[model samples]
Target: MSLRVEGLCVARGEAVVVRGVSFSVPLGEVTVLLGPNGAGKTSLLEALSGILPIQAGRLELCGREMSRASRVVRARAGLSHVQQGRVVFPTLSVEENLRVGARDGLEEAFRLFPELEKRRHTPAGQLSGGEQQMVVLARAILSRPQVLLVDEMSLGLAPLVVKRLLPVLKGLAEGGVGVLLVEQFARLALSLGHQALVMNQGRLVYSGPASALLRQPELLQWAYLGRSA
Candidate 1:
């Protein structure tokens, strides 16, 4: 199954943020969305998660149309979003946070990130940045989503911590979950992605194999800078 978007448009109030975007995130593959600031990557991810309404166009998951589904409906339909920043309840214990995601799957989540089991009773705010990110990830994993949208997951984190976290996403993709990732670190995202798409000012400028983009930095530079390669 795959998550498909066609002519997708999103707006914030009166201003359009994403314009006529079309792409597909297939099962067992990582599709990386790359662009510089104000490139509309986050807006597109938010639309896919159903947090932002689609001003136009269509969305389909597993071949079923979900263009107008609510955020909660999308979540129940196997969609999980790990937004920018390590979002967790600071006052709640780690277990409590996971419980919020789902009452079960604690063991599986802990198995994926064993460090969490040791800190299960600790308040999430007390954990290190990386550890807190793990909690967010573990919570998403516990939900057992078929399609995962991760927006700027590595922001404000150390390189080592990012290294540990990204592989978990890759592993999830390998195990038949479609992962749509928007990462600030383009090189690292390209390395893990199977397909890549670049955006510029709310439109897709490039779409191709991740390896192809790696071999051609100028294309990426052009898309981000509006310069001739």
Candidate 2:
């Protein structure tokens, strides 16, 4: 499934949030959205997921246009999003939450993150932050989406936990799913993604091979290491 965003623009009321953002996530690989806070990364993800309206431009899933698709239409078309904040049903059991990811159950995500299996009966709110986030992702994966838009998977988690998550994401890309990961840490995004796009004030500033960004110390400094933008 090829996911294409051509001149995609999103707005909040009359104020534009994501302006003319164009990029393509070819099937079977990971593409990272690198940006600072308030860069419209989450808004773009919302647009792609059909949760927010697009003020202008287009989104294509496979060959179909999605700029005006309903939320259910988007979900059934194989687009899944794990938004920031890991909003799970606090009262729901872990297994119940996993069930929300897919009807067939938690086997696949449990296979990917075995830790979930052991605590399947616990309440979602009882799990640690990383565990809860994994449960959220597990549910999204169960939807069997071809395109996955993940926002801040590393937010407020230990580096080691994030380190573990990236490999599972890699396996997803290797298996022919398109991943659009919105990341706070450009270093991690560049290291994990096949390609990277930098977003600032809702516009894409730079885009190219992850390795290319990785090689330029000055660019990394501007992005994650924190010198200039």
Candidate 3:
């Protein structure tokens, strides 16, 4: 496994947003995290990436314990998080944004996102939503992380645009990176995932093969309602 979590818990101020979550993101696979709104999906990703402090439980990256590690430490230890919003330096060019992650990875980033190469000199703010997302993803990829945590990469984008991006994530998994994806489009995400996990109200209600969940809609519905099938 590239990333492992055991009984992980996280609190937002006084309220606990994530409760006793445990899972493993194996290398060379995409693990889709599905849940309803306010189900703590984003919180779990934040905790895993060190954006939020882990109140309890263990976090291991490539077999190294890092529960108490800072965000910088986690990033350096081969973890990269492409957050919900397409965060990029508005005035910076696509090539410049990628270089911020790793100067040597510019060509590799351009190769993965040829569209970005065409606009290499264009400022990020001028790109469309889909293009901006590509820049964010490319920046994360430039880091060459062992585990990638992405939250809502499809937010506010057209379905066709989302479809185009999904394959890239799968390709990353095929190339030995463990991808933990938190997405609202359950069906779309499951179609590309090797494993599926369903969360409800800060707790995991389902964990199994992605194909299994895809085949059984009732099971997924039950999980969304915080009940066992």
For this target, which candidate reaches the highest TM-score against the unseen true structure?
3
lDDT of 1: 0.91
Q: Enumerate residue pairs that collide in model 3.
A: none
The alpha-carbon deviation from the true structure for residue 38 of candidate 2, after best TM-score superposition, in angstroms, is 1.5
Model 2 scores a TM of 0.94
Ranking by TM-score: 3, 1, 2
lDDT (tens digit, per residue) of candidate 3 on 186-220: 89999999999999989999999999988999999
Local distance difference test, each candidate:
0.91, 0.85, 0.93
List the candidate 1 regions with Cα displacement exceeding 4 Å: 227-229
For each candidate, give its TM-score against the true structure: 0.97, 0.94, 0.98
Off by over 4 Å in 2: 220-229
RMSD of 2: 2.2
Overall local distance difference test of candidate 3: 0.93
lDDT of 2 by residue, 1-229 (tens): 6899989899888789998989999889899888777888899999999888988898999999888999899989999989889899989998998787677856777898799899988999999999998898888888898999999998999988898888888888898899999876667777878988888788887778888888885775565432334
Off by over 4 Å in 3: none
Q: Candidate 2: lDDT over CA atoms?
A: 0.85
